[model samples]
Target: MSARHIILCINVGSSSCKFALYSVSGGAESIVAEGVADRIGSSGGKIRVRDANGRSIAESDRDLARPQVAVDALFDEFERLKLPRLDVVGHRIVHGGAHHVAPEIVTPALIADLKRLIAFAPLHMPGGIEGVEAVAARHPKLPQVACFDTAFHRGMPERAERFPLPRELWDAGVRRYGFHGISYEYIMQALGADVPTRLIIAHLGNGASMAAVENGRPLDTTMGFTPAGGFMMGTRPGDLDPGVILYLLEQKGYDAAQLSRLVNLKSGLLGVSGLSSDVKTLLDARGSNANAAMAVEMFCYQIKKAIGALAAALGGLDMLVFTGGIGEHAAAVRAEACQGLAHLGLAIDPRRNDSNQDTISAADSRCRVRVIPTNENLMVARHAARLVFPAG
Candidate 1:
């Protein structure tokens, strides 16, 4: 029998760090443990862990105020639980820019390259980098791989990759580099043999974006340049007019810092509704609060429009998938987004959709609408395993 190898997949978000441990031997794999350090840098933060069968292994309050602290806490829990030593680590890096496309073993050069690209994803890169550095500090010789979220979109055609800017700017790495690529890649893997010829995946979550895939190749995506570009998200006002930014700077005396805060933090559902950034929160209050109602409407409206645009990009739509936190759970959002798309032969059975079934499409609908839960952690682990344990 071959030896089992444990892989730790680390996904560092803006406010949380999620880690999963997978045990792989021979041709099989299973999750041995998983946990998340939530509300990092906030009061009342907690780190929770669970075993393979979803049993709580540990739960405790801690001052997880930074990525390094959270990483140390998780490693400490692993020791307390006496878990097997990890063979490798995988990290979900949000941006790879135009250089680091494929999954690569983390190195000093790679770290330096990532640091240079931090300006492209200022809010996310630091946490990812911190996670990597913290892991290195704890397990000096342990192999770590960086699985880029922008890698899946590297095959996009030049027309789709280019921005309507000066050639010099495009050459200087100013172009559409899609995000949520790890999720999209997982969705495609989950489809396996049944993958469609023309598909659009709407990974709706706190951060939302859509990708148009044709014959398993990425054609285009909603997010351009950064994660903040796609559509309206929980906090980001996606695809804002450049003139609005110019006006804010030239007329309103808004500096770069203030503009970044407004566009990335203060806008979107929370800005529009003057409420929480959570979709469920807005949904619950939509009936009573006009602003909340408008916010929901706007979210759905943008999604519907993006579907049409992506569908056109694919020449047609064979399957429409919804995956992510909001995509998998929020039935109302799905229904509203697909409401007026009958012209594209898309219709959802209300009951199936409300139940959050795997296949929510109406039988007669030409486009197959599905709700597939995305597992980006698993994808990162797979890439790490492939790179680190090639013979396994």
Candidate 2:
């Protein structure tokens, strides 16, 4: 057996593709290189490939009409690098439906099944499928593994996973399928035994969600069945009452396509503030702009409510972890979310929270609040390595 194995972790978004290469020796893995192809299929499409030390390896901006075009460009860079014999390609797939509760080697049949799931999460699945297909076409001989974002929540109890819809709908597989499981998995791995039994992890980013984890298993999550349903995000509304959708369709003159665009693209922070969807921009403007203040308030309010709900789900909260972009860096948001949750025994140490620390909980707080930077790609690489070589 070879001493070194290369694992390529691919995370494809709606108009972007991020990949990281890792080298595994024995049981340890190290990041070899990583970068992203963004604004895909547009005239302004650009890509940047960087080494592990944050130095640029390759960069480009060229007109394109599809993500595959950008992906093909990536393949060109790979050939130039000629890194090593690739052992496995691990893909980040958003939804696995009721099937695919674990990592599985890619096959045509598996691809077909995943394609059928596109309607469930139309915004995300297509890009992931496109990335997987591109890899299949470019390097058909190499073994590929798919790591699911929903697979981590596979152990959720029947009640938690079931929607209140009719029994027929349940039989037809219409139930809650929480997303962002890979990131959550990484947090659990990063926390290990130090992370108390009952935990609540808030993954705040462009697409945000909160999870109730008891003994390292998911009991419930804020985002149910789709990425758009969760805490308000950069551009996506968190949970909306079913009546809102009905009213929009009947009285607000909204077609399915229009509603999709509004809910998934034009809403959230942008809609709330009537400004940019970026958190940094909102944070800067919140003090002076009423709309920005409201947006920030709404975002924190939703997160606080979710934390309370998850605390109830876990019977009690022990460890509260913050990850992702806003969760890791946005101290104000974290502070705001924990403001009214003191009754739940959660409090953030202002100094530790402001500074970059592993645990941000105050000494007197009953719950251990943490700030853990998640590594979804590393989680994918580790899962892929184990799947490809169960015993090494």
Cα lDDT tens digits for candidate 1, 324-347: 999999999999999989999998
**For residues 1-392, what per-residue lDDT tens digits would candidate 2 score against the true structure?**
64778999999888888999999878899898899888886668887888989999888886546767767887788778776667789999999998889989999999999999998889889989888898888888988999999998889999998889999998887888899999999998898778678999899998899889888778898888788887899899988999999999999999999999988999999999999888989999998999999999999998999999889988888989999999999999999999988888988899999995888889999999989999999999999989888774
- Tell me the spans in candidate 2 whose CA falls farther than 4 Å from its real position: none
Best by lDDT: 1
Tell me the alpha-carbon RMSD of every candidate: 1.2, 1.3
- How high is the CA lDDT of each candidate model? 0.94, 0.89
Error of 2 at 283 (Å): 0.6
